[model samples]
Structure formats: C-alpha cells, structure tokens
Target: MNTPTRTVPGQFTIVLHSHLPWLANHGRWPVGEEWLYQSWAGSYLRVVAMLRRLAEDGATDQLSLGVTPVLAAQLDDPHCAASMYEWLADWQLRATDAATAPDPTRRELGVREFQSAAAAIADFEMHWRHGASPQIRSLASAGVMEILGGPLAHPFAPLLDPRVRQFSLREGLADARGRWARQPAGIWAPECGFAPGMELDYATNGVEHFMVDGPTLRGDTALGRPVGDTDVVAFGRDLTISYRVWSPKSGYPGHPMYRDFHTYDHLTGLKPARVTGRSVSSADKKPYDPQRADHVIDRHVDDFVDHVRRRLISESERIGRPALVVAAFDTELFGHWWHEGPIWLERVLRRLPEAGVRVGTLATARRDGYVGAPVDLPASSWGSGKDWRVWNGPQVEHLVRLNAEVTETALEAVDKLVDPAGPRHPSGYRGGRSRVADQIVRETLLTVSSDWPFMVSKDTAAHYAVDRAHKHAHATREICDAALRGRAGLAERLAHNWSQADNLFAGLDARRLYTAALPSDTGS
Candidate 1:
C-alpha cells in the first residue's frame, strides 16, 4: 500500500478539531457560557450546515472533523440547548437595537445579524433542539464527514499519568460512540500530543489512525506511517498548507476584507468592522461588507488550491511516489475567529476536487492505500516548539501542579471507594459505590483540561482559564474530602451540585482508571 503508481501527484485531507472546555453553569457574561454559545452559533452550527450543503451538492467524506468528547457532551446537554435558544433570541433583539441606532453602518450590520440570528434560531429549533447528537449523527451517517474522538476533557494526554491518560482515552471513545451512535476508528490526540508508546494504547483501544505535527516525522511526512510495530497510523499535518490559513502573523483571517473578530460593538455585542488593515485601530476600521468578504474568500480558495497543488507536485517528484498532505486546524477557526471561514472552507473543498487534488477524509486516505514505515515518535505537541512547553512550562507550572495533585486525589478516592477485588464494570466500578467515584473522576478530568494552560500561556483568556481550573480543582477536593470523611449526605449533595454544573460524560465509568495496562505510577 505504501507504493504509489498513480499519475496523480497527491491526495489532500482537511482535519478540523472542534473542542471547548465544559462551560455550562460556569458563568454567563463576558467569559463562560457566552463563549460556548458564540462558538456554537458562529462555528459549529455554521460549519456543519456548510458541510450538509456540500453533501447535498454531492460531496461525501470530503474532510475529517475531530469533535472532542467534552464538546459533544456540552452540545448535547439539555441546559445548553435551552440556554443557547435564549442566547440566539437575545442576539436578534440586540441586532434590532443596533438596527434602530442612528448610524447607517450599524443598521446594516444589525440587519445582517438579525437575519443570521433568526436563521440560527430556526436551525437550532428544527435540528439541534433535541441535542447535537442527531445533527452530528446525520452528517456522519450521510457520509459527509468522518468523526475523530479524543479524551473526555481534552487533556494533554502525553503529560498525563498513564492511568489517567488511558482511562480518559477509553472513556472518551465510549462517550463519542454513545453520542453519535458509532465508534470512531481514529482520534485527534488531544493537542496532537503524542509520547513514545502511546500508539500502543491507540492500537489497543481500536484507534486505527491519528494526526501528529509534521515535524514529528522529521520531514518525512508525505505519507501516513505506522507507529512502532502497531497498525495504528500517524498522519503528519503539512504545516505549509495549514499555516497558510491560520498562522500567528499572516493567514487568510488577517486579510483586510474579512470581518474583524476583536472589534466588538459595545452596545449591541456584535462585531461590525472589517479588519481594514493590520495596524488599523478598531475604532477607525471600516464597516464589514459581506460581499467584499465573499470576494476575498474566493481569492483565498484559489490561493490554497494552487498552493496545495504545487506542494503535492513537488513532493511527489521528490519522493518518487504520490504524496498525502493534510491541512488541519481548529473547527472554531471558521465561523468563530474567522467570520468568513465557513464560506472559504466550502469554496476550498469544492475547488480542490475540481482541481484534481483528490479531496477525501483521513479514513479514505488510509483506505486508498497510502502507507509508510514505523517510527518512534518523540514527546511532542502541536504547541510551542512542537514540544510540551506550552502545557508544562514555567508560566503554567502552577496549573501542572494543580492538575497532578487533583488527579492523584481523585484516583486515590476512587480506589478507596470502589472494591478492588470485584468484577470491573465497564464504567470502571463493580457497582454500588460508583456514583461518588464517577463524580470525582469527572471533576478531576475537567480540572486538567489542556485549555487552562494553553490559555494561560497564550494570555488570551488567562484569568478565565485560572478561575475555571480552580473551580474544578475546588470541586474535586471538596468531593474527595467529603467521601473520605464518610459524609455520605454531604458528598451526595456536592456531587449533585457539581453534576448540574459540569454535567458531561453521563455514562463515565471510573474503573477504567484502574486498568492494569497502565503504569503503576499515579503522578501526572
């Protein structure tokens, strides 16, 4: 399968990783639930709709979408469903307020927002009201996209305790199956973080493929390679292709014509300005024009297709075989951070196929017979320096300590609560004592999300990230203390409260943490 005799130079796959920390009942204003709702409206719903439209136009499995277990849980939460509906309605009312304002630009933007909010509300009511599962399931079932699963809380698995990592991976895949009604064959290793031997876990857990950063392959990433002796293949993202759309300094999103994400209309809680220019002040930026944005999208779509074409042709000639290039990014990058993202994505997907780029899902790539030799992957992440610094550096050392301590305490409590000698139930316990144990594990996982450290290191939303980490940590400690003290009534109350607030992975089993395949070490 590694041999490529075809005339085509390459195959292209786009990987979009979608994730958010558990934010339900956390806060409401500028930071918490608001963030979730915005991403839901701005990104998830819109991107899925775009794909569905493409599917209607005859595209199938054109890309791979990694929807982490944590995000899926929140999307399916009943509380989120009700709250999101209210949020969209509020959006419409705010747009009306903007429309009635004295400024013509504000009025135009408001009209656009009003239409978007109304349409989103209708879409939510018709499709997502029951839960995101049905909508997500329909896309996968329809063969529009391939789903990628990951840890329940999107923890940096390489930095986690073996038991915790293994447990979370297993539980996360289970959670994905429970929601979408199908098990995924591949996973988006949280943060694309991989350590030596992690692929063994992937192989053991039924993961046939996963993505790693291109550097992880040391420049030989034109094909998916097996990890060690396992059949679980690791596909390296082509950074040249991915960074073309989402780099720190220059990317399609930074273009002058796209809607600016940072500039917000304080009165109406909407962004009404175009980027205008890199150094331009938000106050002086010109109002956004969707028509102009659409033009820019078309330009970017052509640029990307051409870039992929040239790279694939060059690589195939250099390597003496057809190449496989993956352009991966966060799913939220589309409708959330980059306002014109979904439109640009649709154009790229459509154009790439027409340009003979062989657009397909990662699963399709593997099935189409591209393969390479096994290699030992180093401890790495897609973060700073392609290493563990962002998640483990000095700036987030406190968070690392916090995560380690909380995880240990949670595991200790579970070990004490569950009978060590009984039949290990799938949810990780024999029976009776599983409720408190389940809550303890849940809090622990939530506390250790990779988001906290990433946010802190990036300084994007550091304070909110800290507060979130502390909140989950506090809950874990309180629950563990109550359980240890034999305060059943108090522990039950605490668990119930936390459950209402951070409810995700409803079927999480704590016994998975005690599996013998994991190392005996308990520290993170």
Candidate 2:
C-alpha cells in the first residue's frame, strides 16, 4: 500500500469489468447460462483466488473490479448459485470421462481438466456455494480493490430516456449497497457510454467518478478530468498500454504456445490444442503443453511489465507531471477467453511493483491527486470506431427505435397506473404490496440492455440476441397494456409469471422510477 510520491514517477491502474446480461433461465449451450458458468469458474474464481493470495502478502489497491448489478444479482441468485455448483460437478464428470479415453493425448488433456475442475469445485464449496457477493465483498473489505457499480441491467444510458436513465442509475447503486454494504463512488458506466449531460445524472446519484474511453477525453488519459462543470471525474482508459496485452489483431494470448480458445474437442467439450497458428485448421493444431505455455506466460508477463513501466515514465515526462495510466478490460477475457490469463495477471501485478512502477486502483488515482482540470467529454464509447456505432449503428437501428418505443410506453403506463403517494403498491391494489409495476420496469430495463444490440452488430449469437430483445420488448408491451386497461388481475398474473425467469433485484421498488427525479426535473 505504498503511496506513489514525486519520486515514484507515475502510477498504473487496472480495471476489469465483469458483466453478462440476465442469462439464468435463458438458453444453455453456445450462448446463455453457459456464458455465466464458464466466466464464473474460469475468470471469477481464478481472479479472486489471485487477489486473495496477493492480499495475504499485504497487497492493497491491486485493481478496480466492476461487477454490473445484473451480473451481481445472478451471482447471488439462489437458482444460479445452485446451478453453478451443479455445472462444476458436471465439469468434473466430463473431465473424468476424458481421462478414461484410449488416446494418450486425450488422457493428458483429461488429467489437466480434471485437476482444474477439482480445484474449482473445492473453491466453489468453500467460498462460492452461497454466491459471489460474499467473496467480492471480502475483497473490497480487505482493501484489495475498489468495486465499481453500474446500471441495473447494463443498459446503454446514453440512448435511454432521461427519466429512465436517472432511475436505472439510482436503483443500480442501491442494488450494490444491498449486496456489498456500500454503494460505489465510481461506476464502469455500462460500456463506457456517455453523453453531454449524463454527468449531471451521475453527480445527482452521488457518483464521484466514472470511466470512459481515451478518445472521449480527446486522448488526454494521463489525468482524469471532471466532465463539463460537474465534479464527477471521468477516467479514460489508456488503450496504448492495454492493447499491448490484448487487442483486435495481436496480443500475448495469440502466441503459438498458449492454449487455443477456438479449437474444441467435440467429444469432451475440452480445448486440447495450442494456438499453433492463426490460420491453422483445428485438425492441424498442436497439442497444448502446459510446460511450454508456462514459459511463454512468464516471458509475456515480463514484457507487459516493461511496457507499463516505459509507458508510465514516458507519459509522465510528456505531461511534465506524475501521470496515471488506466488499463481496463472485460473480466471474462482472463481465464475464460484466454486460458493463461489469470497466471499472466498475477505475474504482472507482482512484477510491476518490483519494477519501480506503482500499481493501484482507479479510486486510488482519483484520491491521490492524479486528476487534472475539467474537460467536457464528447459522445463516445470503447466500441468499434470509439463511438456509439456498435450499439446504435445502422445494423442495429431497429433496436434503437424499439428501445425508445418501449421506454416511452412503459413510462406512460407507470405514470398513469402507479400511485404518486408513498406506497409500495399502486393506487388501485388493496391486497398488499403489488409487483406489477416493478415487473413492468424490470422488463423494460432488460429490453434496453446494451448486450443485445452489441451481439447483433458483432454477429456473435445474433439470432439469440435478437430473440431476447424482442421477447422482453413484447413482455413490456403486453403487461403495460393489461395494467393500463384496468385489468389488474391479469396484469398481476403476467407480472408473477414473468418474474419466475426475469427476476434478479427482488428489492427493486418501481416507485423509484417516478420518485427519483433528476435536478433538471426540479429546475435546480
């Protein structure tokens, strides 16, 4: 926990955003609940283990971890928690099956998979059986890292209705507080999406800072800047240093010795091949050798440490001050997408401090006076072209229009049906606290998740993405129609039925949608 001073040259911050849409009851293989379980076992389990080891050695401010509310809910959900344990058990069985195979290569692969699965199962029973909340909370409590919260469903706030945006942000932070015992002062901003006045929404919600792409700050990422006239700082990602590890065309994971992510052995659902060459066919790929990969990982770790040290020194010299370089990436990229990622992460984190480069979290940067004067950030994202094109581009124009329509319809219905008085249930319901309005708001929020359109535009699981988007949109419309038509009985029934699968934040009070008004609404 050594603080970087004038003699330290500069500081480096690692931000890993852990997110996946509500995928619990959705499809399983290729792209649904499987995504949740894989990331949980591969990235979450391994990453947290690494952090615990570091913390045991008295490391603080290791990194900033962003767990979106939707993902947090799933991680803590009883159904998902139980299902994840079952998934780990099944993985052990599969590894055993692979171990008994006739081929020596398959036997070797099976042995490796079995050992990994065994470790994962032991870890799950000991720490993750209840859910991920306790583990994440422990890390934050230990001061090992800062936790960043985001909107309820990881929506693209820049395109959402102003009222809905405000509601989502407030409810999101509340959800975090419920899970972790404290609401985060900083957020990942759901894809780093930002618009001209979103800073006001952030400031109103007690957010002291947030993340954005380097281009949003016009490449002045050496220091976080206050957006517009607000005190809410926007820390931009240093893509130069980040891309050195992983990028579109090149990265350490693409090395020929590393395990191949794409080539899977259909029989055992295991990846037994090494990334022999980018253009190499699956049949021609080399068998993965952990020994060789371990050597390469060590080399890559040294290379990355050197890169960060050089970047810090050069950026500090260029800025004429001790600069801050923030490298952010999706948490799933480690262990899940890149099998050797957790190992490399541990090595780099340990190596940087010894290499005379200070490593800390984003919160540390802001508090330690690494911030500069205010800069009005522009409309931008970390997506392709560093703009909103990936989420709102021509390919997904239909979704943009659909989100607007559904948001407006849901808002109108809530306005008409919900009681303005301080009550859990709306005006007409006398039985008890009704959840019809809550379900409506929930469906509407799911419809606008940035993941849907991003999937379609990327053409990865496009059909599934389209189906999920329309499914939620239809639920919103039907429930809103029923409630508006005074069919309270039918509306309540629909809400209850949909709640079976769409449920996540059980404490979400729909009244907040109307009660939490932005400053502009009151003309303050």
Candidate 3:
C-alpha cells in the first residue's frame, strides 16, 4: 500500500452526525434515557477524547460534526447532565462488583471494565460536568472540527408544513448559536433527507452547505454540488467508502477479533466476548482480548486508508479533478455499537494525512472550492431504498397522516392567536407573549419528528415510538383547541404540564413561525 509520489492526492472528509431525540423525561432502561447514557459514556466520551488528543497534536479541520438541536438540547439540559453523572457513578460501582467476582472470566472482564469506568468518570468530571456544550464549543473554537445544526425536533423536512419547517430550522440554528456562539453554515438534514425546494428554505436561512445521500446526486459524489439555483451546496455521502467501515451486511466492526456488541454478560452488565464468528452462539463465544482487538484495529486502519487512497485516485481521474471522498456515520456507531470504532477512527485520521491524502471539514471543502456544478436533487433519504419509504412508506402511513394533521392544526391555530404584526395573544397574552401558543408549537414539533416512523418501520422500539407520537399529538390538539376556544385557563394549565417534560428551547416564540405563502409543491 505504498503511495504513488508521482500522482496528486485527493481530499477525504469524515462526517459524524451526533443525534438522539429529546429523552430528558422519557422512560429509562432498555430504550429511553438509557440510550442517551450509553452513547454518552461509550461513544461521546471516547470520541471527544480522541479528538482532544488530536487537537493537542495540532490537528485542525479533522471532520464535520453534526449535533441536531433536539440532541443538543438534551446535552445541555441540566437534568440530563445530572442523570449522566449518576449513570457513570453507577457504572463505576458495577465494575467494582464485577472485578471482585468469584469466577475468573467475570473477574477478568471486571478488571477491564473497572479501568475503563475509572477513565470515563475522570473524563466526565474534568470535561463533561457542566454539559457537552463547553467541550463541543471548545472543539469548534479551536478549529478542530466544524459543528453542524439541524431542525428543532429533527423532523423529516420534505413531509413537514412549510411554516413549521422554516420555524424549526431557524430556531434550531439559533439554538446552536446560543450554545456554541456560532450558527452552523451546514446541516445534516435529518436522515440525509432532502426534497426538491429545500434549497429555497436553506438559502432563506443563510445555510451555505448541507448533506444528502450519494444517490440523490445520481452517484456523482466526487465533489459537492449546488442545489437548484441556490449557492447552498449539498455534499453527498459516499456510500461506496462509507460501507467499507459500516453497512447492512458487513463492515470492519464485524471482524472476528473485534469486541462483540450483542454478547453481554448479564451478571456484570458488560460485554465479555469477541465476534468469534457471525454464526457462533453467544454461549460459546471466545473471551474478548484487548490486545487482539488492538492488532485487528491496526490492520483495518491500514486497509481503510488504502481504500480511501485508491478511491480518491480513481474518482479524481473520472471527474477530471482532484476528487473529494466523504464518509459519514452516526457518532454512536463508534465505541457504543462497535467497541474498537473510536480507536480505529483516531488511527484513520492520523494515517490518512501521512498517506498523502487531504483531510478537511465540509466547511473547509466548500471554502477550498471542492464543489461542482448545480444539481436538481429529488426527494430522497439515506433510509431503506435511499427513498422516503422508511418514513412515508405504507408501514408507517398512519404517522404520515398524523404529522400532516398536527402540523396543519398547529400552524392554523398559531396564526390565529399570534398577531401578524407583533407578538400578542388575543385571548390571554401574559408577559407580552403567548406561553400557550409556544407549547402548542412544541408539541406539534414533537409529533412530527422523524424518529417515530423510523422506529416503527425498523421495528426497533416500535411501541414506545408510537406511544410518544400519539401522546405529543394529543397534547398539541388539546392545547390548540383550548386556546382557540378562549379556554385560556385550560390552555395555560395544559401548557405548563407539558412543559415539565417537553421543555427545551425556552426562548421559542410561536410568532416566529414563517407565515409567508409557500409553493404548492412543498406540501406533504
């Protein structure tokens, strides 16, 4: 895998989208808050540590990072920050118990777990005590990476009412600015989802760039392409290179030497086995060996670096310019789902530059002129079939209809209550703003989130997803009805109650909802 010194090298960009829905007051264990804690400890902690190390070594423009507003809100929430600290303390206690187990295997796993847990606790105390905002802001401020922003609730843009879409997108960016002191120029459109005229909304919001699935560009992903007639660039994720790291059937993480994600030791609540074989039963799986996994990581890093080099060369030749290879993934895939992923990522980031490949953030790419001609991207997502099937398919048709109904009802209600000229609630304006209208907008945004239908279609926590959607829809309807009927007392009560849980973006004002007429085609 020697680099050809005679040839010019192309650029490589890694995009990590860090997101989870609002889970502050949600259920715990198997699915709710547990999901947040696991990813925080297993992935976020390690990934940030790796990036910090790289930054210390004078690294800059390392990767593009997307933190959706819904997830950002959770990361910055006081309740979530406190809960995560408690979870880490519990992890330490469990590791101690495991380390003292009578069985040798359990004891060995416990020893390893204890060491990891101690490191996590130290990291949490040192950098994550306040919340993720400071750490992430530092990374961006130091020029280590570019942070991406998204809509308030991560709604599927193409299916949302134009007004809601605009409001959410604007507020989401404002949320990021409030936290990090910079409004992101780029966004990971929820699920890499895009509709035809989204460029107009993006341009309206001053977005300079965004991401989409490679197929959306018809597979010409060697460079970023402008959407429609706007200068807003859409960088397509190169599935060809991305799948080499992770895909449906196979990936580097599936190697036999890597730690197995599914085989857990129920006694200690720690994974204790390697991926001996895809077909090997958990009971017969071999013990996890960190030394063996380290060796495997080194080899895989070499392989991936070579793959990127080769892809860059070939794509450059095809496109008649130095090509750009963008490999994007969910941040949780590392450390959380694939235990060795963070280490592999750090190595890849280090080795790529040494191998004569250019590494930069998406912002850097756009600024460096790694963009091509304009493209009229169609409705698409990175979901099943690279289309809207996972969101709008028959399996979740009910959710689609519900989203439309709730969005329409919410917009109409807000329009009536909010004075078009200013922020005033005709029925019961308090403190110069409509708290009731704000809550209706909040519930409406939650109802239209893309997570519910995605979970149902994937059959992962489907019941919980359905329950969340319905609950939010009911709240939205009730609040809207109360306010519109002049039941100010009831509306205020309901709004206050719902705010106990669905509270984030405290500065949100319903009057900010976009009221301009939209093109007919923008409807769901």
Regions of model 3 farther than 4 Å from truth: 1-7, 421-426, 514-524
What RMSD does each model have against the real structure?
4.8, 3.8, 3.7
Candidate 2 accuracy as TM-score: 0.95
Model 3, 1-524: lDDT tens digits are: 96564434678999999989887787997889999999999999999999999889999999999999888888888899899999988887888888898989888888899899889989989998788899999999889999999988999988888778888888888778888888899999999988899999899888999999899888889999998899999999998899998775778999999999999889768899999999999999999999989998999999999889899999999989889999999999999999999999999999888888889999999999899999888999999899999999999999999999988898778877875654555575533468888899999999989999999999999999999999999999999999888888999999999999998888787766744421212111
Instruction: Pick out the ten consecutive residues of candidate 1 with the lowest summed lDDT.
Output: 515-524
What residue runs in model 1 are displaced by over 4 Å at the alpha carbon? 1-7, 422-433, 515-524
For model 2, name the residue pairs that clash.
none
- lDDT for model 3, on a 0 to 1 scale? 0.89
lDDT of each: 0.87, 0.89, 0.89
lDDT of 1 by residue, 169-234 (tens): 888887887788888999999889999989988988889999999999886778999889899999
User: Deviation in angstroms for 451 in model 2?
Assistant: 0.4
Assess every candidate by TM-score: 0.94, 0.95, 0.95
Q: What C-alpha root-mean-square deviation, in Å, does candidate 1 show against the real structure?
A: 4.8
